[model samples]
Target: MDRLARRLGLRTDPHIFFWSAGLMVVFLVLLLSFQQPIGDAFGAGREWITTNLGWFFILGVTSWLVFLIWVATSRYGNLRLGKDGDRPAYSNLSWFAMLFAGGIGTVLMFWGVAEPISHFASPPFAGVEPYSVEASQDAMGISLYHLGLHTWAIFTLPGLAFGYFIYRYDLPMRVSSVFYPFLKEKIHGPIGKTIDVFAVLGTLFGVAVSLGLGTSQINAGLTALTGVPDAVWPKVLIITTLTAVATASIVAGLDKGVRRLSNLNILMAVGLMLFVLIAGDTVFLLRQLIESIGIYAGDIVPLSFWNDSMAQFTDEGGWGWQAGWTVFYWAWTVTWAPFMGVFLARISRGRTIRQFVGGVLVAPAAFTLVWFVVFGWSAMEIDGIGGSGGPISAAVADSVPLAMFAFFDQFPAATLVSGIAVVVVALFFATSSDSASLVVDMLCSGDGEAGPVRQRVFWGLSEGLLAASLIVLGGEAGLAALQEVITVIGLPIFLLVFAMMFALIVGLRRERVPKPVEAPARHQTAEPRPAQESPPRAGSQT
Candidate 1:
């Protein structure tokens, strides 16, 4: 049997491809056959889970924090990324792209338009006074909570676990690496190959979902602003266009294309915000910002654990949709974690775990919340005092950028907001495509940039191709199916994330070194590493 398996080239790296495909098929079949029953069951289950597992996530967050602290204070903090602790793998732009792509930048594009309005319509707590009032401060709170620390913690665990074990421990850089420490020695064989297969499938499903969502939103925005039809063809066309661009950038390697695109995207996002602050509702917007921040801080916990209780918020006909949003976001982040984490870990040598968790996880969350505050707050002001909510609301469920256009064109600033929107979308899509292509290349080749330029280009085109296929399939259902697969396959890795946290903590404590020993007779000591994650060198950050 072993001889035959080897001859057939059967794998040993947690070959989960068949399993992921089966699991996703099962999920979809169940979705089609027992969706109502499953939704009802899962809906209640999530509420119960939230009520019971509030601490589950909190525990996850806390443990991750401790592990980070340990790394900062240990010999591990002195480590860098090269083969023998040489230096970083890529330039600043390339590293950031890898992180941002997996970090949910596309969601930022989606949420900038949809989230504020979502909270405005129905915040987490009914008792809050702002429930029905347009531009309720509570709404912004929910939006922030959705984009808050816990969400990143939930999502980042798998990535960190996968990266440390795979990249750090010299295990194969696959999602299956998370389960390696637990699998004993057998994980290096066929069973491990099966697991890796599932992980790859999981990543594909997740990326497919992202591509579909991104294309839809982009298509919707283009349709609203331009006279293009919001149909299957346009979405398909956009996907094709994006994939072509991604292929070219990936081929150009990280130094040239990926970094250039990401920096451009970040700059555009800043410029768009600046335009709103400069030309949109200045006074009302300032007031909205304060209220939104307060609402976010106060209600974050509840929003993070919200379960619809069979109550879909009125807009979707039940709070279940909100539940879907939470669950889906968590899974998407987890699914993308491995690729992003590896990419981050690859670039982040010479830095402490504290820095990685803090900068990558914490800082990004802060930036995202701020972005929400600016865009959502501005939209809320328009909704409350002006009739901006009508256009925003009408477009919210469809495309976020379109919704923003409606809100921004409120009075005298129509053309200015429109111009900003154009700039943001252009950079936004480029960032996503470039990062995604790089990630796909990593999976296809051992290194992120190892493939020949043309090879990377082929993979780059694949991203757009699958997205176009999804568009041809039609409707939100197609997109939802793709997302569901990512979430389902992403489920097992969550446990692996917890396990990695535990392992890192244990490893750190066992090997922890003290600063210096002081005695009465003689105060002699050797220099010690700092008790925090080390900062990256000048070149790495750049």
Candidate 2:
């Protein structure tokens, strides 16, 4: 096997790849084979955590935000990620575009319209009347809150940590590198390998969540537009088809494949948003955009700390709301952080610490606010005016996959717009899979070498298989189950993030202090320095 692998030019940490993929395949197989039992178990465990540990997710994410800001504004902010004088490999436009494409562009597409509309019907707090003006305002506020800085802050930490340690210290680009300050040479030992393994696993599950949801939305779009049956088989087929597409890109490597795909994803997304903004309520969206920013800015602090226990004027939906929405979003972001972190670091060489934090936490977040404003506010206005017969609300209630399509239904050339939305989503799905495969490959091969095509293709296939299995086994229920499992898995990662932050601070402080030069030996005299204005030496050319 080794000789054959050598001949094929396929070099990888076989244990990392095989163990990660092998374990994933085993788990997926068991879940598919015994869906009911696993779903039941997951559901029970999920409820327990959502009920008990909701506060932890809230606190963890809030601390991450504070920590990220401090790092950005601190004395270390000016430090370059790479050696002094190194410049960014990619252009700023491509850098930010890929950030969105990798982090949660597909997630936004899946939920931008759907979540706010859902919140409009049921505000997070107890007393707000559903679908009322107050409800609508709070809905966008909370949606922005979730998709806004708090979430970005979570994603930024690992990226910042990875970039700082990996490039600055010449450390290998892997999840375990974040712990180098604390672990030192131990990062190469079993503990370090374990961290990397968990990172690969976390990334696998995180990407699966997006892939499964995107596939569901694509399935819904097809059914809505073409009268295609929305069944497990169709979703499975969608996964298979798109995974093949993603496999081709994954083989092309990051610069050619992921970068180009991400740029294309951003372009498609911008076109779709522009179409909605212009074709939908232009003035209303503009007003909502300004208002949403104020609301998010004014209420972000309270909202960041808002949890079931803190809901003073309570309702029955208190803890349930936190679990279903806030905790779930945080958990999802935390789980996806490993993949986002590595990918961000990969593209972030030559940037300063401040530039990285600002770009990761600010740019994508600003885009998210605008996205929710246009998609969320427009959906709310349409539903509010349309009443019970409103297409947007009805879709949100019955089938979230169809919500984006339903939102487009209120506009001109609805079918064309919906078709475009589907294509954009497909590309988001592909970019996400392609990037994730790269991250997992790095984890397996234990560096940023991009590994071999075989390894990338292997992880890509594993991701698709896991996503397909989850969709087929549990459908929407299965996706929820997977999310619950993710939140559960995120407990350790949450702690690891805090450790990384501490390690980063220590690493930066050490870097900031210049190493002292030793005195010359007592017997040895220093060479005399030449005078700057000295005439040319005899051997100098004049």
Cα misplacement distance, residue 193 of candidate 1 (Å)? 2.2
**What digit string (tens of lDDT, one per residue) describes model 2 on residues 1-542?**
34544666666655455566677878888887898887778777777777778888898889889988998887667666776667799999999988899888998999999998988886777787888888888888888888889989888998998887777666667777778767767776677768887788888877887898899899889998999988889999999999999999999999999999999999999998998899888998898888888989888889888776855355453356788788888877787888888889889988988899999999999999999988898888888832433678788778878889988888998888889999999999999999999988876665776887887898899999988877876765645665766677676777777787788777766653222244321222322121232211111000
Residue 451 C-alpha lDDT in model 1: 49
Q: Each prediction's TM-score against the native? A: 0.75, 0.91
In angstroms, give how far residue 340 of model 2 lies from its true place.
0.8
The residue pairs found clashing in candidate 2 are: none
lDDT for model 1, on a 0 to 1 scale? 0.56
* Alpha-carbon lDDT, every model: 0.56, 0.81
Tens-digit lDDT track of model 1 for 168-237: 4455455444454456444545665565554554555556667777776766666656778877777778
Clashes of each: 33, 0
